[model samples]
Target chain A: MVKALVFDAYGTLFDVHSVREKCNEWFPEQGEAISQTWREKQLNYFFLRQLMERYEPFDQVTREALRYACKANDVTLRDEAEEELMEAYLNLDLFEEVEEVLSQLNDKKLVVFSNGSPVMIDPLIDRSDISGYIDDVLSADGVKQYKPVPAAYYYAQQELGIEKEDILFMSSNPWDISGAASFGFRTAWINRNGLPKEELDIQPEVEYENLKGLLEWRD
Target chain B: MVKALVFDAYGTLFDVHSVREKCNEWFPEQGEAISQTWREKQLNYFFLRQLMERYEPFDQVTREALRYACKANDVTLRDEAEEELMEAYLNLDLFEEVEEVLSQLNDKKLVVFSNGSPVMIDPLIDRSDISGYIDDVLSADGVKQYKPVPAAYYYAQQELGIEKEDILFMSSNPWDISGAASFGFRTAWINRNGLPKEELDIQPEVEYENLKGLLEWRD
Candidate 1:
């Protein structure tokens, strides 16, 4: 009886690592490392900021994370290179199955609920092939809070005008699933990496390898 | 003018990685990897739990983090090995200069304020050589909130009966320093590794290579 499917954007639908090519162009032989560290620190910055009650938009956090990633990887991030790398986030590649699955699930309301700022996520969605399949895009920025914070998910529930139990929230990030599930949404953990589940006491109600598995929920 | 000095226990006064030897004995070459991931995941769990309003005690969080770290590194963690590794946390070695610095700053009230539960941090403090130098130990467990969250620092301040400005909070972790600084405490970042500063908008009042720098602040 789920009426809407809310998907996490960055890792669940978009390939954040797609920026590796641009990063590799700037930092030869270090693109993969920079991208990996950048992604890790990006999430860390969000969690840290949320805990400290210091909320910065995702774009700025992404840039700061890039700067740290570059320094940690021993590469200098030239100003222009940084701008181009940041640009790359706006045009991230969609996961191989995203468009097909979204199209199939179009009868059910499909929404993007993410920690990504609208300035970043809007363009990303519009540029992607699945944009037409999405009914709404919600950003945590609207609430000035990040995911895993109850307020962020509550904001989404309120905006969609849907009951939490009837909204299936999907995220590749375990922490996000923990948050959404704890906030009362029926959760589907899109564990793309097949990695171990986080040891957090809360568990997602369902687990899937990718978005394709999400098609099972479409009514 | 500072009347009290509050310190972060793990990685500030105590070497959290000192558990490497025990980890190595249990898992051989994977010890270093396990310890590093264990520490990183340990902090991540605290931040995640704090954001989700799921407040598990630090000891429980530490144990869960260890379980994930072992699974992540592709090592099998036996039940007995898990208990032994958890035991190592109680007996972590202090940073080389911690005892000397605390001894030198005897005129100042020295306190250990940590995310650790009292059950964990109490024995850790009592067993350490600097036990005689410490005046009080305050734990975030009392507030059921982790550091970087304002409540945790406020708990420390109330317990010590000191004004925020007159308390110099020291930690090797930048996020902890940011939290303490934002809460109005004078902060000293013990940048033992000389890593680049995090891009959080806040900055510590002072930066030092190690505990020895605390001696400089004494009246």
Candidate 2:
């Protein structure tokens, strides 16, 4: 039952919401609104780009969404603010328990399958001091699709030389978990929002409250 | 050339978020969060279903997402609460100016192209007192595609029996406006959020703060 535990980067193993903290420091007037808009727009861009069939780097897409949201919310962040936001992205905080949970899963193959570029993810993983425990880092750029794309899961499987069934895909986004399930991979949806998955035709094989639950989960 | 004016139903013509007012009476503890999560998951379901080549009535999708979000936020509602929410959806408040603006364009073929089901939308139009001004109500259920899907525009055009070039698609969602534009229809994006459209290599021919701008728009 032990195979690869493929962890999704944003909102799964990492404290993606902490990106808000960094924004608050820069644009105090409308920081919270700008940050919320940025997150919403970033996800919107992901799906929009997928539908449009035009792939762009996650960093570029994230930056574009942040810039527009700042403007819309009447938060004027100069070029330096933009750079600071991008730096925040590269330096995203790891969830408080991510390192310990990941270490427990280290006995099995541990891989990072993310929509982010290697450049963006590498620094975070390195900063977490858990890079040594990771077996591989797979980027969506190679597959030309973001999470919730079947190809994204397939890319990680193909790159790791494992069957879909051998990879236990994990993500906080229900759609990403749905995609993995559809692709015939066993999945543990990290429902950190404490929500149920949207009623899709396929359901996840396992649902965990967070990585801690997932750490104790054995198939 | 006055040919046709199309409007997005949610947030543009109808005040969909006004439903939040009733949330306090039902799930007072997490009313605001419940409402926000419902809207977010509703869009998530639409995009995921469209990407997966599956379709469901927006009401079913809406109810499912609502239930998920409510549970996630620890808000428990009685069955009557569901009925109340559904009723709220059908009884949306139109902006003070929406009726007057639609009246101006009524002489020139006004239509509603919505992401709602006919069941969900038709009732709203009937209750909102603006049904008399609309010539047609087109829903994604007709095409098995949601807004931002290229097929939504094509299906609307075919249903309207109008050439793509002659139809003006209007929406507050940039993704939808961009999709309609890519589908070869002219679009006027209602930038109600004051945000620029992300760089998707697609652009709306017109941009406006509200539908009133469209009444005076001459092209």
Candidate 3:
């Protein structure tokens, strides 16, 4: 019996890529390049920081990665437009299935396990106002290390007060799914982009292209 | 006070991107996509594996990353051709200025600290015939973790019997530079592509566009 659903917030619960629209609105053709590279660099920086023991908040990582992304793509951040994009990022729209599936599964505890800082995550939840469904927000700063580090998962487990097997852990990142699975959670990989499994030899218990797959299964 | 000049093997001394020529040769007009994606996936796998603690040999990582890159880029890896590429990989030619600079800096104890497996690193050194300059080979398998991990650098420091700052660490990767610098080694980033520094806030002591810059520095 799954007692609760633990979600990886950035890509699994909220669509990190949804910033592409605001990006495109601001910069004509460079939005996709900026958005894609920014997201990739953001995660890459997370791993680098964790390994190097130079921990920074996720919001700072986001801005710094964006700076690198724009520079790498030969785009300029002018007139404080980058700030606009960052602000818009905080209100990132939920994935099409997020609200519905989350509501339908209200009987189970809904928890967010995020790398986002409280300042960054709390507003997004407030703006989206689906905050009611969530029982807890476990941001990585709680442990001073990001996810995939065993310490981060252990912290989440202690807070959730549920046995690892009794929780359904969900993430859209293959690496996160692998990490969570390796940590003994029943993992769901929300592979929204239809990417291949990470070649880490560990496999998630199930995968969905979107969040609704979880709802459909639970229904 | 720099007693040894430690190098990163894959991209700093060897031309990893040279695989693009063979990739283009094997699959008509698909070389750049295959090579770039292959290299990116290779490093991505390193971080993922290290974090997941499901470490594999670097050679195995090269093969697996290539498999993913080929699939991601819609290119098929023919059986004999992948074998052919792996064989070619073993004999990757030195970067244009690698041998010349190593010869110029022969007074220093030149060393290689790589993520390559011995099977991969030893043969590459032998085939390239630059074994005379390198006094030591420290592969990551010694600790079963990839670079930017403190343990990997720690092993190298112990093996060299030299203090961290006394080792002039060199790599073409910004993350490696950042990691080494954080580990208290003076670092030289071979920024061959003139790429921006990683957002980690740890800048290298010096940077070069290629290996020749190191020689030019000592001169």
Candidate 4:
């Protein structure tokens, strides 16, 4: 029986692209491109850092990614403009279905396990309507290891005090799902984009279009 | 004084994007986009596999990356087309200055250290005119650890029988340079495109526009 539902916070529950509006305000006609590049570079930075054994908090990674994205899109990002964009991450829009689904799954332990640092994630959760529905927030920062590295998932499992098979891990990112599944968790891929599954050898046990799919889970 | 020069083959010596012409033949206007995505996903798969302890040869990773890139660009890749594209990797065009530079730096041990499987890399080197100039070829497959991961670099160092500081690692890819730098090898960022540097904390010891800059390095 599953004892807890651990969801990846960024793309799974919070809309990472919500910052596009603020980005647009700073750079006309380039918001969407900047946001897309920023998100891709952000994850790329994480993977590179993890492989290089260079761990930085997610906030720093996000900022560096933004800088690269701006350069790539041929836009200049000033200090104040960068700060505003960074603040936008703290107030990211939660996916529309997140609150209702978390409320329904309140009987189960609902935790946010993410690469996001607590400084960013805590405020994100505290500001959201589903804050009360979440039982815990775990950051990869705590272990100084990012996802897909076994240590990060193992840290979450230890913190939850549950066996890996008794925890259902959900992530909107295919790579995250692959990582969790490889780590032996019962994974649910919250593939919101309706994209094809990644070619990684590991497969998630279940696939969901959104959090509401979690309601179908028994025990 | 540098005892040997280690190079990253894909982007550093071989122009990975040179396959664009073949890709264009198959996908027309979408060739550049497909090639870019294919290269990005190829490296991503390597990092993810390394982090997840799921090791696959570079040939398989390259093929899988092509499949995703084709799907992403909305192109149908027949088995024969796939074979052609995969074949293109083995015969990638060497950067214009690679042969001249390698011929000039013949005094030092010139090694190709890469994540590429020997199956692909060996033939690639054998087909290049610079083959006579290269001293040794070391692959991540030898250790089942990809670059940016310290173990991979250490494997190359062990195979070369040289100290880290005495080796000058060169790569057109910033992440590879960063990884080699972090591994304690002196690094040169072959910024062939004159792109901005990545924000990773580690920095290469030198920056050059292309392989020709290696000519200035003296023991």
Candidate 5:
């Protein structure tokens, strides 16, 4: 239905929990909490930065949020664990079904639209050796904003030099999907949490449990 | 010092932990997680709605976030306990030191700047019997956008009919303080979490461990 299928990166492509699981081994005492706080602050930083009209790479925000989380949880880590967490994030294993689905979706243009910084997402793709399969990776870097901002969708559209209606956006986060949907993109929601749609004014055009469901959905 | 002394209701005045403690008694199984999720979604709704140019009452978002959290966590509630959470939120007990400090600050123009609805915060003051002491109860009702938006602060400023610099905004949440600071209001950060100051571009003019710290400095 759309020329390009744009997927969200963190929860959709990468195994976020598994990355935390790996981090837990090295920072045994506070790894799990670190992971959760890191994720929370990651989202928080994205929103706050967008509001402030300042943008930094996701890696920098990741480090900042990770440090703040450590302080909040009373976990003391020298620079080592921060580096470890960064490394763990950069080397995340793609979801079990990600590559297969991406291959199938590759019949059309496949792009990643993420709140991640270029430094963070690019290295992951390179390390995973999926660079050949992806046509583009668009980060929120330029706009200093994250998804759910209509401007975020506009950034991706402008960067790719494509019309908004021709881009099929998908995200695991309901708020992001709602933003994309409202911004005039055809959206497929990856409802990993199985939560019902929010009572927002806008709604996603398609809903699937995950990427596999998306792959099974014929246009 | 600035003229108006604005207080944030949830964590600064009301003991949010006590609110959760009350929740733990009711749901017992999934209460804590549900409470946490409720808080997250409540804020998410506020920020998302603000971004979308749609304004709903904070109480509505609170209820929706609670419903979604309960459903997400598989916590089924009977009638009263479900109602009790909202009741508990409205009738929240002020922290042990709240009344004395607020009484001391009553010499200045005082306002309750909250993301809550008028109905929500009005009852809170009425239930606490501190209604007469407060100069004004400013909810995000009229503006339809919640705090952290320039528009929300502008609404508060417009309501007070005071210069932005004349308002001394205070919040237990750093982001609120950051937002207020960005909104051109002088701010005092109530760092109850004892967390480090984030690297946000905005900074508070004053920092206190709690409201009591402000009382000592007040002339």
Candidate 6:
């Protein structure tokens, strides 16, 4: 029954925390703490900016959050190291199953509904060499708002000329699943780490251990 | 140019984490963890719910977040103790300068713009015995949205018949100050713990260590 399959980019297909290795190489012993703080701050700023009605592009949010995280951890983020980390983000390795799963999809019009800015996500998807498999890429900047804002999902619906129920929205993050489902889409969650579902009372139609497991979806 | 004053209730006027003692008592060695997780989850649910377009009243948010936090910390939350902790929330102690500062206000209409439900905020204000000092208590439920939502702030402006520039919004949270300022109100941050300013590019018109220092605002 699903017409279009929409994927969340960060942490679903892209491994965001992979930057920790480069961070470790640069910051030495405190790399993990800084990287952890950076990720947390990055997500926190998205929520904060959305609530405040001040929309910052994902690139700016990432950079500013890194600055704050570095300051918090007493790490001196020199210009080169800062560039190195951000450049590393654009090349985050896909999970082992991502390319294989995309190749196995049988004629579903696949697309990405991402919070990343076009300039950031487009290059990453291209560099990952999986751009050929996806039908289109959608970004929150199309409406100047991020998920799980209803309008963000609505943008995808209007663009594809499909009903919400006709789209299968998937995310590894529990909150994204709840949001897309709450907005009336058929959602499947990739619960890779097997974390407990969020307490929001919303559940996805299917749960998968990894991208490869998505091959089992029938509709 | 300021015509009236609006105060953010939590963490500014009332100490929300004061219920930690009860949490500690019930959870034993995990009291601090339970309390910290509870507070984090509570704020997180606010953003998640807001983004998901699922609104829960502040009191309900508190209960649900507390429940999740207890589960995460591996604490058995019996009904009796759960009620005890939630009830204690409604009786949180006000900072020492709250009443004195409210009392010292000259002629500006004093009001609270809070995320709390009336049931929660009213009793807390009453039990703190500071009901006489304030003019009115406005809850987010009145607008069906919570703080940092521009609509939530604009509701106060419309209710009080004041221009945005004429209302001085004060919140201890740097993010709240940024939001209020971006929404066109003059803001003062009660930086109680001397936290650094957020990187959001909006600065409060004034910063103070406590409510009494609000007396320093000349406008």
**Candidate 6, B1-219: lDDT as tens digits:** 888888988899998878888888887778778888888888888888988889989888989888888888877789999899999989888988898888889477888888889888888887785788788888878998877789888887888898999998889876677778878899899998777556667788888999888787786
Rank candidates by TM-score, best first: 1, 4, 3, 6, 5, 2
The per-residue C-alpha lDDT of model 3 at residue B126 equals: 74
Error of 6 at B75 (Å): 2.9
Pairwise TM-score winner, candidates 1 and 3: 1
Task: Please provide TM-scores, in order, for all candidate models, with all chains considered together.
Answer: 0.97, 0.88, 0.94, 0.95, 0.89, 0.92
Candidates in order have lDDT scores of 0.92, 0.81, 0.86, 0.92, 0.80, 0.85
Give me candidate 2's TM-score against the actual structure.
0.88
Error of 1 at B82 (Å): 2.0
Off by over 4 Å in 2: A18-25, A28-34, A126-128, A193-202, B21-34, B193-201
Over the stretch A14-60, how does candidate 2's per-residue lDDT look in tens digits?
A: 87667787788887656678777888788889888887666788888
- lDDT, candidate 5, B150-192, per-residue tens: 8778999999998988888889987788888988998889888
Ten-residue stretch with the least lDDT total in model 6 chain B: B193-202
Give the 10-residue window scoring lowest on summed lDDT in candidate 4 chain B: B210-219
Give the best candidate by TM-score.
Answer: 1
lDDT of 3 at B197: 68
lDDT, candidate 1, A7-81, per-residue tens: 999999999999999998998889999999999999989988898888999999999999999998888888999
Considering only chain A, what is the TM-score of each predicted structure?
A: 0.97, 0.95, 0.94, 0.98, 0.92, 0.96
> Which number leads on DockQ?
1
Model 2 misses residue A160 by how many Å?
3.0
User: Which of 2 and 6 is ahead in lDDT?
Assistant: 6
Each candidate's DockQ score against the native complex? Answer: 0.80, 0.40, 0.63, 0.67, 0.44, 0.56
Error of 5 at A18 (Å): 4.6
Each prediction's fraction of true contacts recovered: 0.87, 0.38, 0.58, 0.67, 0.31, 0.56
Report clash pairs, candidate 5. Answer: none
Q: Is candidate 5 or candidate 6 better by lDDT?
A: 6
